[model samples]
Target: MTDMQHKPNGWNLPINQMTEEEWKDYFECRKKYDIKLSDEEIKKIIKIAMHFIDTDHDKYMEESLKIPVPPNLAISYKAFNGLKAMKKFNLSLAKETYPDEF
Candidate 1:
């Protein structure tokens, strides 16, 4: 979020954990910028995300317990998944849009 031009107060905190003031800031910040995804793109993300959750997540969690400190696995996993989705989406979109670049 360091790269964000506008971010809510306590953006690092989970939505349910946020204060009312932070929620207000969040809504206001949301109005400042938007990245609209196509319906197909959204569906693509959903499919990819669900596949990970259904197929790989259990194994990932099982393996993670081997580590003494997984650094807030719930939050870390969500963030990692989000970044992974973004990277996959970007790579896919970029490849289709700029085939020559690859």
Candidate 2:
């Protein structure tokens, strides 16, 4: 299908349905040569990422019957948030040093 076929309104498509060549083009367009998210935005993204981590971990256990949950199958929200915050902070620093990369 042509790229236009995937546009719901303005050219956004479901990533899973993208053809190889179309996906390549999409990535090319998304290549940010000089864009850095603000600290606030990065923090928000990390918070969202924590939710995904929890979801995927549960999904994996459900899918793999042989896998057993540990006695303490718990994740510390505080620690994860802290680590994510630090990671985003570091990414911002790297972006400053290499002002021409994603």
Candidate 3:
């Protein structure tokens, strides 16, 4: 099957990368949960989930033995928003030394 034929199973997949069915499911989910997030917020969430987290506790669920269980949307959204805000606050407090990042 082609990539488009593959089902998107995660909330972490970027919006631009989602398949057509995935987009339908995504909108349905957002509507059901009353989630209204900007594209940038969604991107920040994807970035954090894909790049920053070392361990995903959600992957441990036993749903017909699926290896990677998708993270809970409400929890992830709330946590990601708080994390984004906290990181922004922390960055403001940190000293800017030379070569802070390589």
Candidate whose TM-score is highest:
2
Candidate 2, after superposition: displacement of residue 61 in Å? 18
lDDT of each: 0.37, 0.33, 0.32
Model 1 lDDT tens row, 1-102: 312343323344453344556445444433332233576755665566565665698654433322222224323443444322222122223323332221
Candidates 1 and 3, the one with greater TM-score: 1
Lowest lDDT 10-mer window, candidate 3?
Answer: 93-102
lDDT of 2 at 75: 20
- Best model number under lDDT: 1
TM-score per prediction, in order, is: 0.26, 0.29, 0.23
How do the residues 18-98 of candidate 2 rate in per-residue lDDT, one tens digit apiece? 455655554343332213456676566556556566568754432332222121221222123321122112233333433
lDDT of 3 by residue, 41-96 (tens): 55655565554345664432211121111234323442444221221121211112
Give candidate 3 misplaced runs (Cα > 4 Å): 1-32, 52-54, 57-102
- Checking candidate 1 for backbone clashes, the offending pairs are none
For candidate 2, report its TM-score: 0.29
* Models, CA RMSD each: 15.3, 16.2, 17.1
